[model samples]
Target: MAGGGGALEIPERQKRGKIVRRKKKKRIGFRIDLTPLVDITFLLLTFFMFTTTMLKPQIMEMRIPPEMYAKVEVRASELLTLMLTPENKLYWYKGIADQNNPPQEISISKLRALAIEKNLEPTVKNRLITVLKISPEANYARVVEILDELNQAEIPITEAITKEVDEKGEPVKRQRKFTIAPLTEEDLKLLQGEGK
Candidate 1:
Protein backbone atom coordinates (compact mmCIF):
# COMPACT_ATOMS: atom_id res chain seq x y z
CA MET A 1 0.00 0.00 0.00
CA ALA A 2 1.19 3.51 -0.82
CA GLY A 3 0.30 6.43 1.38
CA GLY A 4 -0.07 10.16 1.19
CA GLY A 5 0.36 13.62 -0.22
CA GLY A 6 0.36 14.15 -4.06
CA ALA A 7 1.42 10.54 -4.77
CA LEU A 8 -0.55 7.94 -6.77
CA GLU A 9 -0.18 4.17 -6.06
CA ILE A 10 -0.85 1.09 -8.14
CA PRO A 11 -1.02 -2.46 -6.73
CA GLU A 12 0.82 -5.26 -8.49
CA ARG A 13 0.62 -9.03 -7.86
CA GLN A 14 3.91 -10.87 -7.48
CA LYS A 15 4.64 -14.44 -8.73
CA ARG A 16 4.66 -15.69 -5.11
CA GLY A 17 1.16 -14.29 -4.54
CA LYS A 18 2.45 -11.21 -2.71
CA ILE A 19 1.12 -7.70 -3.56
CA VAL A 20 3.49 -4.78 -4.42
CA ARG A 21 2.82 -0.98 -4.40
CA ARG A 22 4.21 1.42 -7.04
CA LYS A 23 4.28 5.26 -6.88
CA LYS A 24 3.36 7.58 -9.77
CA LYS A 25 5.39 10.73 -10.58
CA LYS A 26 4.05 14.26 -10.47
CA ARG A 27 4.16 16.67 -13.49
CA ILE A 28 5.19 20.37 -13.20
CA GLY A 29 3.11 23.13 -14.94
CA PHE A 30 4.79 26.09 -16.60
CA ARG A 31 3.69 29.81 -16.47
CA ILE A 32 5.10 32.88 -18.21
CA ASP A 33 5.11 36.58 -17.05
CA LEU A 34 3.76 39.03 -19.72
CA THR A 35 4.33 42.33 -17.83
CA PRO A 36 7.82 43.10 -19.33
CA LEU A 37 6.71 42.20 -22.87
CA VAL A 38 3.66 44.50 -22.59
CA ASP A 39 5.81 47.30 -21.17
CA ILE A 40 8.30 47.13 -24.10
CA THR A 41 5.47 47.14 -26.59
CA PHE A 42 3.96 50.31 -25.04
CA LEU A 43 7.42 51.92 -24.89
CA LEU A 44 8.00 51.40 -28.61
CA LEU A 45 4.55 52.74 -29.41
CA THR A 46 5.13 55.91 -27.42
CA PHE A 47 8.58 56.38 -28.98
CA PHE A 48 7.15 56.30 -32.49
CA MET A 49 4.28 58.58 -31.51
CA PHE A 50 6.69 61.19 -30.16
CA THR A 51 9.31 60.99 -32.94
CA THR A 52 7.22 60.67 -36.13
CA THR A 53 6.75 63.74 -38.29
CA MET A 54 3.32 64.69 -39.58
CA LEU A 55 3.10 66.35 -42.97
CA LYS A 56 0.89 69.39 -43.44
CA PRO A 57 -0.84 70.19 -46.72
CA GLN A 58 0.55 73.18 -48.56
CA ILE A 59 -1.94 75.71 -49.95
CA MET A 60 -1.95 78.88 -52.05
CA GLU A 61 -4.48 81.61 -51.40
CA MET A 62 -6.12 83.69 -54.16
CA ARG A 63 -8.82 86.33 -54.11
CA ILE A 64 -11.38 86.53 -56.93
CA PRO A 65 -13.60 89.47 -57.85
CA PRO A 66 -17.31 89.18 -57.10
CA GLU A 67 -18.53 89.90 -60.66
CA MET A 68 -17.25 87.33 -63.13
CA TYR A 69 -18.63 89.08 -66.22
CA ALA A 70 -17.52 92.59 -65.30
CA LYS A 71 -15.00 93.92 -67.78
CA VAL A 72 -12.34 96.19 -66.38
CA GLU A 73 -10.42 97.68 -69.27
CA VAL A 74 -6.65 97.67 -68.79
CA ARG A 75 -4.32 99.78 -70.93
CA ALA A 76 -2.02 97.88 -73.23
CA SER A 77 1.04 99.89 -72.16
CA GLU A 78 0.45 98.89 -68.51
CA LEU A 79 0.06 95.18 -69.23
CA LEU A 80 2.89 92.67 -68.69
CA THR A 81 2.05 89.24 -70.05
CA LEU A 82 3.85 86.02 -69.16
CA MET A 83 3.15 82.91 -71.22
CA LEU A 84 4.22 79.43 -70.17
CA THR A 85 4.42 76.68 -72.81
CA PRO A 86 4.27 72.88 -72.53
CA GLU A 87 7.98 72.68 -73.34
CA ASN A 88 8.72 74.54 -70.07
CA LYS A 89 9.67 77.63 -72.02
CA LEU A 90 8.74 81.06 -70.63
CA TYR A 91 7.98 84.11 -72.74
CA TRP A 92 7.21 87.62 -71.52
CA TYR A 93 6.19 90.81 -73.27
CA LYS A 94 4.99 94.23 -72.26
CA GLY A 95 1.72 95.50 -73.74
CA ILE A 96 -0.53 93.31 -75.90
CA ALA A 97 0.89 90.16 -77.56
CA ASP A 98 1.02 90.94 -81.30
CA GLN A 99 2.16 88.72 -84.16
CA ASN A 100 4.16 91.58 -85.64
CA ASN A 101 6.14 91.92 -82.39
CA PRO A 102 6.48 88.52 -80.76
CA PRO A 103 7.16 87.91 -77.05
CA GLN A 104 10.78 87.73 -75.98
CA GLU A 105 11.88 84.41 -74.46
CA ILE A 106 13.07 84.73 -70.88
CA SER A 107 14.59 82.39 -68.34
CA ILE A 108 12.86 81.74 -65.03
CA SER A 109 15.86 82.93 -63.01
CA LYS A 110 15.63 86.44 -64.48
CA LEU A 111 11.86 86.74 -64.06
CA ARG A 112 12.02 88.20 -60.57
CA ALA A 113 14.35 91.03 -61.60
CA LEU A 114 12.25 91.77 -64.66
CA ALA A 115 9.05 91.93 -62.61
CA ILE A 116 10.64 94.31 -60.14
CA GLU A 117 11.99 96.52 -62.93
CA LYS A 118 8.67 96.70 -64.74
CA ASN A 119 6.68 97.32 -61.58
CA LEU A 120 9.07 100.13 -60.67
CA GLU A 121 8.95 101.80 -64.08
CA PRO A 122 8.11 105.51 -63.76
CA THR A 123 5.35 105.36 -66.38
CA VAL A 124 3.68 102.23 -65.00
CA LYS A 125 4.57 102.37 -61.32
CA ASN A 126 1.79 100.95 -59.14
CA ARG A 127 -0.30 100.51 -62.31
CA LEU A 128 1.36 97.65 -64.18
CA ILE A 129 -0.91 94.60 -64.49
CA THR A 130 0.73 91.19 -64.74
CA VAL A 131 -1.19 88.54 -66.65
CA LEU A 132 -0.04 84.94 -66.40
CA LYS A 133 -1.32 82.60 -69.17
CA ILE A 134 -0.68 78.91 -68.57
CA SER A 135 -0.95 76.14 -71.18
CA PRO A 136 -2.91 73.08 -70.12
CA GLU A 137 0.10 70.91 -70.95
CA ALA A 138 2.47 72.98 -68.79
CA ASN A 139 3.89 71.52 -65.58
CA TYR A 140 2.05 72.56 -62.45
CA ALA A 141 5.30 72.93 -60.58
CA ARG A 142 6.51 75.56 -63.05
CA VAL A 143 3.34 77.56 -62.46
CA VAL A 144 3.93 77.34 -58.72
CA GLU A 145 7.49 78.54 -59.21
CA ILE A 146 6.31 81.52 -61.26
CA LEU A 147 3.70 82.43 -58.64
CA ASP A 148 6.38 82.17 -55.96
CA GLU A 149 8.65 84.53 -57.84
CA LEU A 150 5.80 87.00 -58.29
CA ASN A 151 5.01 86.81 -54.57
CA GLN A 152 8.66 87.44 -53.72
CA ALA A 153 8.64 90.46 -56.02
CA GLU A 154 5.59 91.86 -54.23
CA ILE A 155 7.39 92.73 -51.00
CA PRO A 156 9.91 95.17 -52.43
CA ILE A 157 7.41 96.60 -54.92
CA THR A 158 4.88 97.23 -52.17
CA GLU A 159 7.52 99.00 -50.11
CA ALA A 160 8.33 101.27 -53.00
CA ILE A 161 4.68 102.22 -53.65
CA THR A 162 4.54 105.13 -51.22
CA LYS A 163 4.59 104.52 -47.42
CA GLU A 164 1.12 106.04 -47.10
CA VAL A 165 -1.01 104.90 -44.17
CA ASP A 166 -4.65 103.89 -44.18
CA GLU A 167 -7.54 105.34 -42.16
CA LYS A 168 -6.44 103.19 -39.21
CA GLY A 169 -2.87 104.52 -39.46
CA GLU A 170 -1.72 101.09 -40.63
CA PRO A 171 0.23 100.86 -43.86
CA VAL A 172 -2.12 100.51 -46.83
CA LYS A 173 -2.40 97.02 -48.21
CA ARG A 174 -1.61 97.13 -51.94
CA GLN A 175 -2.73 93.87 -53.50
CA ARG A 176 -0.49 92.54 -56.24
CA LYS A 177 -2.02 93.27 -59.63
CA PHE A 178 -1.87 89.84 -61.20
CA THR A 179 -4.31 87.48 -62.83
CA ILE A 180 -4.21 83.94 -64.24
CA ALA A 181 -5.76 82.99 -67.58
CA PRO A 182 -5.78 79.96 -69.82
CA LEU A 183 -3.43 80.01 -72.82
CA THR A 184 -5.27 80.43 -76.13
CA GLU A 185 -4.56 78.70 -79.43
CA GLU A 186 -3.26 81.92 -80.91
CA ASP A 187 -0.78 82.23 -78.03
CA LEU A 188 0.41 78.67 -78.64
CA LYS A 189 0.87 79.40 -82.32
CA LEU A 190 2.84 82.52 -81.43
CA LEU A 191 5.13 80.49 -79.16
CA GLN A 192 5.69 77.80 -81.82
CA GLY A 193 7.14 80.49 -84.17
CA GLU A 194 4.16 80.04 -86.48
CA GLY A 195 3.09 83.62 -85.99
CA LYS A 196 6.58 84.87 -86.81
Candidate 2:
Protein backbone atom coordinates (compact mmCIF):
# COMPACT_ATOMS: atom_id res chain seq x y z
CA MET A 1 0.00 0.00 0.00
CA ALA A 2 2.97 2.31 0.48
CA GLY A 3 4.11 2.25 -3.17
CA GLY A 4 0.91 1.11 -4.95
CA GLY A 5 0.86 -2.34 -3.33
CA GLY A 6 2.96 -4.22 -0.77
CA ALA A 7 3.11 -7.39 1.42
CA LEU A 8 0.73 -7.74 4.41
CA GLU A 9 1.46 -9.50 7.72
CA ILE A 10 -1.23 -10.76 10.18
CA PRO A 11 -0.85 -11.76 13.82
CA GLU A 12 -3.40 -14.08 15.58
CA ARG A 13 -3.71 -16.60 18.45
CA GLN A 14 -4.18 -20.27 17.57
CA LYS A 15 -5.79 -23.01 19.53
CA ARG A 16 -2.62 -25.17 19.94
CA GLY A 17 0.06 -22.46 19.50
CA LYS A 18 0.61 -19.28 21.38
CA ILE A 19 0.81 -16.96 18.33
CA VAL A 20 0.94 -17.35 14.55
CA ARG A 21 1.81 -14.80 11.79
CA ARG A 22 1.84 -15.07 7.95
CA LYS A 23 3.74 -12.92 5.48
CA LYS A 24 2.37 -12.37 1.97
CA LYS A 25 4.85 -11.41 -0.82
CA LYS A 26 4.01 -8.54 -3.15
CA ARG A 27 3.45 -9.08 -6.91
CA ILE A 28 6.42 -7.03 -8.28
CA GLY A 29 6.49 -7.99 -11.95
CA PHE A 30 3.83 -6.23 -14.05
CA ARG A 31 2.93 -6.21 -17.79
CA ILE A 32 2.16 -3.09 -19.82
CA ASP A 33 -0.87 -3.44 -22.25
CA LEU A 34 0.36 -1.96 -25.60
CA THR A 35 -2.86 -2.71 -27.56
CA PRO A 36 -4.21 0.82 -27.05
CA LEU A 37 -0.88 2.37 -28.06
CA VAL A 38 -0.77 0.39 -31.33
CA ASP A 39 -4.36 1.31 -32.10
CA ILE A 40 -3.70 5.04 -31.53
CA THR A 41 -0.61 4.93 -33.78
CA PHE A 42 -2.59 3.35 -36.68
CA LEU A 43 -5.43 5.89 -36.27
CA LEU A 44 -3.01 8.82 -36.43
CA LEU A 45 -1.35 7.35 -39.53
CA THR A 46 -4.70 6.97 -41.31
CA PHE A 47 -5.76 10.50 -40.36
CA PHE A 48 -2.59 12.06 -41.73
CA MET A 49 -2.82 10.03 -44.92
CA PHE A 50 -6.36 11.30 -45.55
CA THR A 51 -5.75 14.94 -44.51
CA THR A 52 -2.26 15.80 -45.74
CA THR A 53 -1.70 17.17 -49.26
CA MET A 54 0.76 15.58 -51.69
CA LEU A 55 3.75 17.56 -52.92
CA LYS A 56 3.51 19.16 -56.35
CA PRO A 57 5.80 18.14 -59.17
CA GLN A 58 8.78 20.35 -59.95
CA ILE A 59 8.73 22.24 -63.27
CA MET A 60 11.65 22.16 -65.70
CA GLU A 61 13.04 25.34 -67.28
CA MET A 62 14.12 25.45 -70.94
CA ARG A 63 16.26 27.97 -72.86
CA ILE A 64 14.61 29.83 -75.74
CA PRO A 65 16.23 31.44 -78.76
CA PRO A 66 16.22 35.23 -78.69
CA GLU A 67 15.95 36.02 -82.41
CA MET A 68 15.49 34.22 -85.73
CA TYR A 69 17.93 36.40 -87.71
CA ALA A 70 20.79 33.93 -87.73
CA LYS A 71 19.92 30.73 -89.58
CA VAL A 72 21.33 27.41 -88.49
CA GLU A 73 21.51 24.43 -90.84
CA VAL A 74 21.12 20.97 -89.32
CA ARG A 75 22.08 17.90 -91.31
CA ALA A 76 19.41 15.39 -92.27
CA SER A 77 21.27 12.54 -90.58
CA GLU A 78 21.35 14.43 -87.29
CA LEU A 79 17.61 15.11 -87.20
CA LEU A 80 14.89 13.46 -85.12
CA THR A 81 11.35 14.75 -85.38
CA LEU A 82 8.74 13.97 -82.74
CA MET A 83 5.21 14.76 -83.81
CA LEU A 84 2.31 14.71 -81.38
CA THR A 85 -1.14 14.16 -82.86
CA PRO A 86 -4.54 15.27 -81.59
CA GLU A 87 -5.30 11.72 -80.50
CA ASN A 88 -2.29 11.74 -78.14
CA LYS A 89 -0.34 9.43 -80.42
CA LEU A 90 3.38 10.07 -80.98
CA TYR A 91 5.15 9.64 -84.32
CA TRP A 92 8.91 9.85 -84.80
CA TYR A 93 11.30 10.01 -87.74
CA LYS A 94 15.00 9.38 -87.61
CA GLY A 95 16.12 11.50 -90.54
CA ILE A 96 14.87 13.58 -93.46
CA ALA A 97 11.80 12.60 -95.46
CA ASP A 98 12.25 9.93 -98.08
CA GLN A 99 10.16 7.23 -99.75
CA ASN A 100 12.33 4.50 -98.23
CA ASN A 101 12.48 5.84 -94.67
CA PRO A 102 9.09 6.50 -93.05
CA PRO A 103 8.00 7.84 -89.67
CA GLN A 104 7.11 5.23 -87.08
CA GLU A 105 4.38 5.49 -84.48
CA ILE A 106 5.82 5.17 -81.02
CA SER A 107 4.62 5.38 -77.44
CA ILE A 108 5.30 8.30 -75.12
CA SER A 109 7.39 6.25 -72.73
CA LYS A 110 9.57 4.91 -75.55
CA LEU A 111 10.78 8.33 -76.69
CA ARG A 112 13.87 8.29 -74.52
CA ALA A 113 14.65 4.71 -75.43
CA LEU A 114 14.29 5.46 -79.15
CA ALA A 115 16.62 8.44 -78.80
CA ILE A 116 19.23 6.22 -77.25
CA GLU A 117 18.65 3.51 -79.84
CA LYS A 118 19.17 5.92 -82.73
CA ASN A 119 22.32 7.22 -81.00
CA LEU A 120 20.98 10.74 -80.74
CA GLU A 121 23.67 12.17 -78.55
CA PRO A 122 22.58 15.55 -77.13
CA THR A 123 26.11 16.83 -76.65
CA VAL A 124 27.67 19.93 -78.18
CA LYS A 125 30.17 17.99 -80.28
CA ASN A 126 27.59 15.72 -81.97
CA ARG A 127 24.38 17.65 -81.50
CA LEU A 128 21.23 15.80 -82.53
CA ILE A 129 18.62 18.14 -83.91
CA THR A 130 15.26 17.27 -82.32
CA VAL A 131 12.16 18.98 -83.59
CA LEU A 132 8.94 18.61 -81.57
CA LYS A 133 5.83 19.27 -83.70
CA ILE A 134 2.99 19.50 -81.21
CA SER A 135 -0.40 19.87 -82.87
CA PRO A 136 -2.72 22.68 -81.77
CA GLU A 137 -5.36 20.15 -80.73
CA ALA A 138 -2.94 18.21 -78.52
CA ASN A 139 -3.40 18.38 -74.78
CA TYR A 140 -1.19 20.77 -72.82
CA ALA A 141 -0.42 18.03 -70.33
CA ARG A 142 0.94 15.78 -73.10
CA VAL A 143 3.15 18.58 -74.32
CA VAL A 144 4.39 19.13 -70.78
CA GLU A 145 5.11 15.44 -70.40
CA ILE A 146 7.05 15.41 -73.68
CA LEU A 147 9.03 18.46 -72.57
CA ASP A 148 9.75 16.80 -69.26
CA GLU A 149 10.94 13.67 -71.03
CA LEU A 150 13.17 15.73 -73.32
CA ASN A 151 14.62 17.57 -70.34
CA GLN A 152 15.13 14.35 -68.44
CA ALA A 153 17.03 13.00 -71.45
CA GLU A 154 19.28 16.11 -71.32
CA ILE A 155 18.44 17.17 -74.89
CA PRO A 156 18.98 20.77 -75.98
CA ILE A 157 15.80 22.48 -77.18
CA THR A 158 16.17 25.00 -80.02
CA GLU A 159 12.67 26.26 -80.81
CA ALA A 160 10.23 28.70 -79.25
CA ILE A 161 7.30 30.78 -80.50
CA THR A 162 7.39 34.37 -79.26
CA LYS A 163 5.19 37.42 -79.75
CA GLU A 164 7.09 40.54 -80.74
CA VAL A 165 6.32 44.10 -81.86
CA ASP A 166 7.37 44.44 -85.51
CA GLU A 167 9.09 47.58 -86.88
CA LYS A 168 5.60 48.85 -87.88
CA GLY A 169 4.68 48.76 -84.16
CA GLU A 170 2.35 45.81 -84.54
CA PRO A 171 2.60 42.66 -82.42
CA VAL A 172 3.43 39.59 -84.57
CA LYS A 173 4.26 35.97 -83.81
CA ARG A 174 7.93 35.15 -84.37
CA GLN A 175 9.42 31.66 -84.54
CA ARG A 176 12.86 30.35 -85.38
CA LYS A 177 12.75 28.29 -88.54
CA PHE A 178 14.89 25.20 -88.98
CA THR A 179 15.77 23.84 -92.42
CA ILE A 180 13.86 20.61 -91.82
CA ALA A 181 11.25 19.77 -94.44
CA PRO A 182 7.55 19.83 -93.62
CA LEU A 183 5.62 16.62 -93.02
CA THR A 184 3.83 15.29 -96.09
CA GLU A 185 0.71 13.17 -96.56
CA GLU A 186 2.95 10.13 -96.94
CA ASP A 187 4.26 10.78 -93.44
CA LEU A 188 0.71 10.80 -92.13
CA LYS A 189 -0.02 7.54 -93.89
CA LEU A 190 3.14 6.06 -92.42
CA LEU A 191 2.08 7.12 -88.94
CA GLN A 192 -1.34 5.61 -89.53
CA GLY A 193 0.30 2.32 -90.62
CA GLU A 194 -1.07 2.66 -94.15
CA GLY A 195 2.39 2.99 -95.66
CA LYS A 196 3.66 -0.12 -93.89
Candidate 3:
Protein backbone atom coordinates (compact mmCIF):
# COMPACT_ATOMS: atom_id res chain seq x y z
CA MET A 1 0.00 0.00 0.00
CA ALA A 2 2.97 2.36 0.87
CA GLY A 3 4.73 1.65 -2.43
CA GLY A 4 1.62 2.27 -4.36
CA GLY A 5 0.83 5.54 -2.55
CA GLY A 6 4.38 6.99 -2.39
CA ALA A 7 5.48 6.53 -6.05
CA LEU A 8 2.69 7.44 -8.45
CA GLU A 9 5.05 8.75 -11.18
CA ILE A 10 4.72 8.04 -14.90
CA PRO A 11 7.43 8.42 -17.61
CA GLU A 12 6.07 11.02 -20.04
CA ARG A 13 6.84 11.95 -23.43
CA GLN A 14 8.11 10.30 -26.47
CA LYS A 15 4.64 11.43 -27.43
CA ARG A 16 2.31 8.40 -27.79
CA GLY A 17 1.54 7.78 -31.41
CA LYS A 18 -1.67 9.42 -32.65
CA ILE A 19 -4.21 7.28 -34.64
CA VAL A 20 -2.58 6.67 -38.12
CA ARG A 21 -4.72 7.32 -41.20
CA ARG A 22 -4.52 4.82 -44.17
CA LYS A 23 -3.68 6.38 -47.56
CA LYS A 24 -5.80 5.51 -50.63
CA LYS A 25 -3.98 3.67 -53.60
CA LYS A 26 -4.09 5.38 -57.03
CA ARG A 27 -6.02 3.42 -59.84
CA ILE A 28 -4.71 3.03 -63.49
CA GLY A 29 -7.21 3.05 -66.46
CA PHE A 30 -6.90 2.44 -70.26
CA ARG A 31 -9.09 3.76 -73.18
CA ILE A 32 -8.80 3.50 -77.06
CA ASP A 33 -9.14 6.82 -78.98
CA LEU A 34 -11.49 6.24 -82.07
CA THR A 35 -11.51 9.84 -83.38
CA PRO A 36 -8.17 9.46 -85.32
CA LEU A 37 -9.15 6.00 -86.66
CA VAL A 38 -12.46 7.29 -87.99
CA ASP A 39 -10.75 10.30 -89.64
CA ILE A 40 -8.06 8.14 -91.28
CA THR A 41 -10.64 5.68 -92.60
CA PHE A 42 -12.68 8.50 -94.15
CA LEU A 43 -9.60 10.02 -95.78
CA LEU A 44 -8.62 6.65 -97.35
CA LEU A 45 -12.15 6.16 -98.66
CA THR A 46 -12.21 9.61 -100.22
CA PHE A 47 -8.83 9.09 -101.90
CA PHE A 48 -9.87 5.75 -103.46
CA MET A 49 -13.13 7.20 -104.74
CA PHE A 50 -11.41 10.21 -106.35
CA THR A 51 -8.76 8.09 -108.09
CA THR A 52 -11.29 5.46 -109.40
CA THR A 53 -12.45 5.54 -113.01
CA MET A 54 -16.07 6.39 -113.94
CA LEU A 55 -17.45 5.32 -117.28
CA LYS A 56 -20.54 6.50 -119.16
CA PRO A 57 -22.28 3.55 -120.79
CA GLN A 58 -24.62 3.58 -123.76
CA ILE A 59 -27.50 1.08 -123.84
CA MET A 60 -30.21 0.48 -126.40
CA GLU A 61 -33.65 -0.95 -125.66
CA MET A 62 -35.29 -3.13 -128.31
CA ARG A 63 -38.92 -4.19 -128.59
CA ILE A 64 -40.34 -7.16 -130.49
CA PRO A 65 -43.77 -6.71 -132.11
CA PRO A 66 -46.38 -9.28 -131.20
CA GLU A 67 -47.49 -11.78 -133.85
CA MET A 68 -51.00 -11.58 -135.31
CA TYR A 69 -53.53 -13.81 -133.63
CA ALA A 70 -55.48 -14.67 -136.82
CA LYS A 71 -55.20 -18.00 -138.60
CA VAL A 72 -53.83 -18.34 -142.18
CA GLU A 73 -56.22 -19.28 -145.02
CA VAL A 74 -55.30 -21.65 -147.85
CA ARG A 75 -57.23 -23.49 -150.63
CA ALA A 76 -56.32 -26.05 -153.26
CA SER A 77 -57.84 -23.99 -156.05
CA GLU A 78 -56.67 -20.59 -154.85
CA LEU A 79 -53.19 -21.38 -153.59
CA LEU A 80 -50.23 -19.98 -155.57
CA THR A 81 -47.01 -21.98 -155.47
CA LEU A 82 -43.44 -20.84 -156.18
CA MET A 83 -40.28 -22.89 -156.74
CA LEU A 84 -36.60 -22.19 -157.23
CA THR A 85 -33.74 -24.19 -158.76
CA PRO A 86 -30.07 -24.31 -157.81
CA GLU A 87 -29.31 -22.60 -161.14
CA ASN A 88 -31.67 -19.74 -160.22
CA LYS A 89 -34.64 -20.93 -162.26
CA LEU A 90 -38.15 -20.04 -161.00
CA TYR A 91 -41.42 -21.91 -161.47
CA TRP A 92 -44.94 -21.10 -160.37
CA TYR A 93 -47.63 -23.76 -159.94
CA LYS A 94 -51.32 -23.32 -159.28
CA GLY A 95 -54.65 -25.26 -159.09
CA ILE A 96 -55.98 -28.86 -159.33
CA ALA A 97 -54.79 -32.14 -160.76
CA ASP A 98 -54.92 -32.25 -164.59
CA GLN A 99 -56.09 -28.66 -164.44
CA ASN A 100 -53.05 -27.71 -162.32
CA ASN A 101 -50.73 -25.60 -164.43
CA PRO A 102 -47.03 -26.38 -164.56
CA PRO A 103 -44.54 -24.01 -162.87
CA GLN A 104 -43.54 -20.93 -164.88
CA GLU A 105 -39.91 -19.84 -165.02
CA ILE A 106 -39.62 -16.18 -164.14
CA SER A 107 -37.08 -13.37 -163.91
CA ILE A 108 -36.07 -11.75 -160.61
CA SER A 109 -37.14 -8.28 -161.73
CA LYS A 110 -40.50 -9.47 -163.01
CA LEU A 111 -40.82 -11.78 -160.02
CA ARG A 112 -40.24 -8.86 -157.70
CA ALA A 113 -43.08 -6.92 -159.26
CA LEU A 114 -45.29 -9.98 -159.18
CA ALA A 115 -44.38 -10.67 -155.58
CA ILE A 116 -45.15 -7.06 -154.67
CA GLU A 117 -48.54 -7.34 -156.38
CA LYS A 118 -49.23 -10.70 -154.78
CA ASN A 119 -48.12 -9.58 -151.33
CA LEU A 120 -50.18 -6.41 -151.61
CA GLU A 121 -53.38 -8.44 -151.27
CA PRO A 122 -54.57 -9.22 -147.80
CA THR A 123 -53.37 -12.68 -146.72
CA VAL A 124 -56.77 -13.51 -145.24
CA LYS A 125 -59.22 -15.05 -147.72
CA ASN A 126 -62.35 -13.03 -146.93
CA ARG A 127 -60.10 -10.43 -145.40
CA LEU A 128 -58.73 -9.65 -148.90
CA ILE A 129 -55.58 -11.66 -148.26
CA THR A 130 -54.07 -14.24 -150.66
CA VAL A 131 -51.86 -17.21 -149.87
CA LEU A 132 -48.87 -18.38 -151.89
CA LYS A 133 -47.31 -21.74 -151.09
CA ILE A 134 -43.63 -22.47 -151.82
CA SER A 135 -41.82 -25.75 -152.41
CA PRO A 136 -38.50 -26.53 -150.69
CA GLU A 137 -36.28 -27.29 -153.71
CA ALA A 138 -36.10 -23.57 -154.36
CA ASN A 139 -32.81 -21.66 -154.04
CA TYR A 140 -32.19 -19.97 -150.68
CA ALA A 141 -31.01 -16.63 -152.15
CA ARG A 142 -33.92 -16.47 -154.56
CA VAL A 143 -36.40 -17.28 -151.84
CA VAL A 144 -35.05 -14.53 -149.63
CA GLU A 145 -35.10 -12.13 -152.51
CA ILE A 146 -38.70 -12.98 -153.28
CA LEU A 147 -39.72 -12.67 -149.65
CA ASP A 148 -38.00 -9.32 -149.40
CA GLU A 149 -39.75 -8.13 -152.49
CA LEU A 150 -43.09 -9.31 -151.18
CA ASN A 151 -42.45 -7.56 -147.90
CA GLN A 152 -41.64 -4.34 -149.74
CA ALA A 153 -44.79 -4.67 -151.80
CA GLU A 154 -46.92 -5.40 -148.75
CA ILE A 155 -47.71 -8.92 -149.95
CA PRO A 156 -48.78 -11.55 -147.47
CA ILE A 157 -46.99 -14.77 -148.45
CA THR A 158 -47.90 -18.21 -147.17
CA GLU A 159 -45.76 -21.28 -146.59
CA ALA A 160 -45.84 -23.41 -149.77
CA ILE A 161 -43.46 -24.42 -152.56
CA THR A 162 -43.08 -26.03 -155.98
CA LYS A 163 -41.17 -29.17 -155.05
CA GLU A 164 -40.94 -31.06 -158.38
CA VAL A 165 -38.61 -30.22 -161.24
CA ASP A 166 -41.20 -31.11 -163.85
CA GLU A 167 -44.37 -33.18 -163.37
CA LYS A 168 -43.35 -35.03 -166.55
CA GLY A 169 -39.80 -35.59 -165.33
CA GLU A 170 -40.79 -37.46 -162.15
CA PRO A 171 -43.59 -39.87 -161.21
CA VAL A 172 -45.28 -37.06 -159.17
CA LYS A 173 -44.50 -39.19 -156.06
CA ARG A 174 -41.54 -36.94 -155.08
CA GLN A 175 -41.27 -34.06 -152.70
CA ARG A 176 -43.70 -31.18 -153.06
CA LYS A 177 -41.43 -29.45 -150.59
CA PHE A 178 -42.53 -26.05 -149.31
CA THR A 179 -40.30 -23.23 -150.51
CA ILE A 180 -40.43 -19.55 -149.69
CA ALA A 181 -38.97 -18.46 -153.08
CA PRO A 182 -40.70 -17.67 -156.40
CA LEU A 183 -41.28 -20.16 -159.32
CA THR A 184 -38.74 -21.74 -161.70
CA GLU A 185 -38.76 -22.95 -165.36
CA GLU A 186 -38.80 -26.72 -164.73
CA ASP A 187 -41.82 -26.30 -162.49
CA LEU A 188 -43.82 -24.59 -165.24
CA LYS A 189 -42.75 -27.04 -167.91
CA LEU A 190 -43.93 -29.90 -165.72
CA LEU A 191 -47.26 -28.37 -164.81
CA GLN A 192 -48.10 -26.13 -167.78
CA GLY A 193 -45.91 -27.91 -170.33
CA GLU A 194 -44.48 -24.44 -171.07
CA GLY A 195 -40.77 -24.87 -170.27
CA LYS A 196 -37.90 -26.37 -172.41
- The 10 consecutive residues of candidate 1 with the worst lDDT sum are 11-20
| Error in Å for residue 139 of model 3 | 4.4
Give me the runs in candidate 3 sitting further than 4 Å from their true place.
Answer: 1-73, 97-100, 116-139, 155-196
* lDDT tens digits, residue span 101-141, model 3: 54566776776666545433444222222234344555666
Candidate 3 minimal-lDDT segment of 10 residues? 10-19
CA-lDDT, candidates in order: 0.83, 0.61, 0.48
RMSD of each: 13.8, 14.8, 23.1
**CA error at residue 92 for candidate 2, angstroms:** 0.8
Ranking by lDDT: 1, 2, 3
| Number of the top TM-score candidate | 1
Q: Candidate 1: give the clashing pairs.
A: none
Position 104, candidate 3: lDDT: 66
Residue 112 displacement in candidate 3 (angstroms): 3.0
Residue-wise C-alpha lDDT for candidate 2, range 20-133, written one tens digit per residue: 344555669989999999999999999999999898777566566776457677677777788777777888877775657667778879876665554434232234567787
Displacement of residue 57 (Cα, Å) in model 2 is: 4.4
Best by the lDDT measure: 1
The candidate, 2 or 3, that scores higher on lDDT is 2
